[model samples]
Target: MSLEAQYLANKLAKGFVGTNQIESNSRLCMASAGTGYKLSLGADGPPGSYRDFEKADVFFVIGSNTADCHPILFLRMMDRVKAGAKLIVVDPRRTATAEKADLYLQIKPGTDLALLNGLLHLLHENGHTDPDFIAAHTEGWEAMPGFLAEYPPATVAEITGIPEAGIREAASLIGRAGEWMSLWTMGLNQSTHGTWNTNALVNLHLATGAICRSGSGPFSLTGQPNAMGGREMGYMGPGLPGQRSVLVDEERAFVEELWELPPDTLRKDGVGQGAVEMFQKMADGAIKACWIICTNPVASVANRGTVIEGLEAADFVVTQDVFAETETNTYADVVLPGAMWTETEGVLINSERNLTLASPATDPPGEALADWQIIARVACAMGYEKGFSYESAEDVFEEIKRAWNPKTGWDLRGVTYERLRAGSVQWPAAREEGPDRNPIRYVDRDGELSFPRASGRAVFYARPHIPAAEMPDDDFPFVLNTGRLQHQWHTLTKTGKVARLNKLNPGPFVELHPQDARELGIVDGDAVEVASRRGRAVLPAVVTDRVRPGCCFAPFHWNDLFGDCLSINAVTSDAVDPVSFQPELKVCAVGLAKVSSPRRPCPSPSSRLRSSTCTDH
Candidate 1:
């Protein structure tokens, strides 16, 4: 068994099973970026801060709707743009962020690797690389040229469907800039080539010597709140607390000693099962029962058919959440009502590595309780009272402060709610020293431009581009893309409760160009059945130029609760990137068949018509 499977087995032996049962929704989101960051930098977490955007000379944002999703970060990026910094947006949609971009490349989806490598090829071919920095601070770059040689400007232009001039413009902006910052989100992370997409971006920064300076580095925007903190706390399978990996003997020893556990108490191997692998195990009945928390994978993860099958096959399932009703709740044998963020007191770590303390605005209602309280109770019930007897959130934070890896400069000693009440504090804070006012990390290690890699040099990965796992074909004639809505959040457990937010976007709809709709004998407001090899969904159509002629867009917020057979994930493919194990949520091949107009505005799930029939409403 892998270390991840053994870890779960150990937990099951202790009568404790959490995300080890399946996986969090992050598997559908940031898993790829996390994998790429770790492999490239020898660690996860950003090497730059949010403040770098202000000092950046050129900014490139790909696969992110920052203006809508991370509005505050977008506002911060806008500050630099107004101050004369050039902005480049890479996306398929003409989003609010893209509209203001100095250069917008609506490149074909899933072709990020080619576009990025194309940038590198231009940088080297045009004498834009910094040789002194490359020689002194990096390694393994010789292999890059041969690998990237295939991605010449013309070839990249052909593959990306972007003009050759636009490619050069974006390439020149990045190559020529002294201080460049690249930001991306789910667009790059939610693809079959997500890891390579990330490494390819990092390769650009390394080739141009654009990283570890005052205003430059690759920064991946966090879509989920406190995702950085979650990683630091060892929320994933392979990692230990404080950026330590389970496979490292010294790290394992460090954690065991701190926790006062016996020798060899922790797993020595780092072979942890990723989210997709865990679900596959569930479907195979390798895992008998499962426990899930804080996420709704049914509506978020790709290949909902497999996810539903895995859940149905489980011997027992427990789910903990703020809402009593959710798609996952339908499969749960036990539901634990835990307090939401508004009712929890804890510290949230932002993309900038700033720790903001969250104090509960009000107490929990009815039988609901804080998540930590539920967890602490579970530990006591399972006979781990001594280790889990945390009376307050501060107690938990203090433990992490002492337990975090000191070698990685991840000290959290002085951070406390009392001190954080004034404002946010960036990390690498000391126990004796006051809060760190600095936001930058690895800006200049050891008072010099250095890195934490083994050779004190960055490794340039010579990545090759691969097509998306699923491509549009004759049977599945259109590309179906799934993503977030400006008004709705993941699975809509909280946002669905807001009347105003729902008014902004009430139901699921697919965006198709008027040309494609006309050819398919479909129009705006007509029911359409989108069928992939994996699953199918029925959605109303909205004719617009927002999407490419051959592509369709669907927001994933609508769960089964919406009544009509609408779930973009249902029609999504489970084929994941081998490197990151993050599924291809952004690209799936689907054939469109117009459904007959229902007698009453879209009836129950069972009443949905076949995709072949179409009629006037």
Candidate 2:
């Protein structure tokens, strides 16, 4: 079905002239990291693997709360830490992960680039770089020193709110490590300067020759299962199957040849609209119809008012999901029930590039079908019979092998469904290379260095630090941030229904500093109305020092389904990075006021988006 979705998207793009609008939900989460990886390392997947974590001498975790978000990986990291590996954490909030850090820099939000550049500057100053590696394996190194000089410790400390001594100590720790690994997620990716934030981190690794090795590399941890596979399958708007881009003629030709299509079967224009732009176009009536699969955009997207408007304004909307009562289904003209986890058989590729096949243990209820089945059925209904005629999941998997371009060093031809059913396998499973699948990337089994770039060398990007799209003013004095809780998953479609999980994390609340709460004349559990330039939401205030004084935090799990106007996306900024188009959901300016009861009624589903007001009951 994954192959069918890609096939149908390509066909639809070919049929529709002058517009290509196929996109994936990863745009909201990992697009910045993807763009950054391609820009600096010449490809998207991590150069190092999870095996590196065990052998690492130092671990640098930024932007992610790994303890709660990725518990199993956190356990592995802790195991390494127990064996004498130093752990460094950088975040705006002093999270549970930070609590265990050997060195924790609780820096200000959205200032990752500044802090990273400062560390790189210090690394160079302290003579920690591998000049030999840079000359041999990397390119564009001569231009970085001058740009890095702009981020001295003093300036970075001021920008990030971490002390100068702390900054220097962090650099020294990273510089002295025998082998270090960096881990990050949406905290760095969901910002206006997200791409540069990633670029700077890669810059550090390249400077120290910390990548393409056993115990060191810059690893972007994905929050979702199969997100890496989705990218490999070309789910991004501008992509074709096997990470090929429509913008590149040779890559397009390869896919066209594999699919047995004509020379110009795929669209040749620019990359298609990202999620933010896609909804904006739908709201503008440029996109007449949309088919959303396995995602709830209304609850998850920043500037969700626009998403709501987009759904309401579109000529037709189809939502294929496992749950019937999703916030997105209210606006969907056609609701297709998709099979749940154990009810469907498919393959999932996890963060470490491990491919695992899941066999169905139970049948789907009612008329529900697998996601791919739904796509193939729709394609056949639309008269694309021959292309969509795949007999089984194994047949689609076979075509996926053909879709891979060997030149990219991501050969999947050796992988068979039979092999996958027995046990999991990491990718770059070349037909010629026998059973051993190397977890590490960018190098051959012979340990030869070869980047997939045009120059066959990893490139260094001279990127600059930029502030968040919206800064706090008197009207909106506090910086509002959103993230996940330990117990609940995204928007709580599944976990919210679990009684134990609900008991662990009962409901959503606004987390502010005790100082801020005192200043606002509020107490713990007080109903506080937080209003941003975009929209507003009211929740109980949890007064603590988990977050910095000038900043506040909220979990984005609750939505209208749980209560009236509980969606925290209402208060998030829609500003996106120009390069990656990933929204800065991590930072926005919002004001807080104590409320007695619900001051305003929750906005109706059919309400105009410009109103920008929401409520909780």
Highest lDDT, which number? 2
lDDT of 2 at 295: 82
Runs in model 1 lying further than 4 Å from the true structure: 1-22, 268-272, 443-446, 570-617
After superposition, candidate 2 runs with Cα above 4 Å error: 1-19, 570-596, 606-610, 614-617
Candidates' lDDT values, in order? 0.71, 0.79
lDDT of 2 by residue, 1-617 (tens): 34344444554454333346777767778877888888888778788788998899999999999999999899999999999999999988888899999999998887888999999999999999999999998998999999889999999999989999999998998899999999998888877777777888999999999988999999999977677888777776777777778888898788777766778777777565578777888889988999888888888877677788888899999999999998899899999998876887788887777878878999999999888788777877877777678788777778778876665677778888888877888888876345645778877769888888877789888878776666766666678777888999998998999999999999999888887777777777677777765567777878889999888888899987887657786221122323222222222223334254456656755554545643221
Residue range 402-493, candidate 1, lDDT tens digits: 66564555667777778888787887777535646666655434557556666767788887878876666666667766677788887888
Candidate 1's C-alpha lDDT? 0.71
- Top model number, TM-score: 2
Give the least accurate 10-residue stretch of model 2, judged by summed lDDT: 580-589
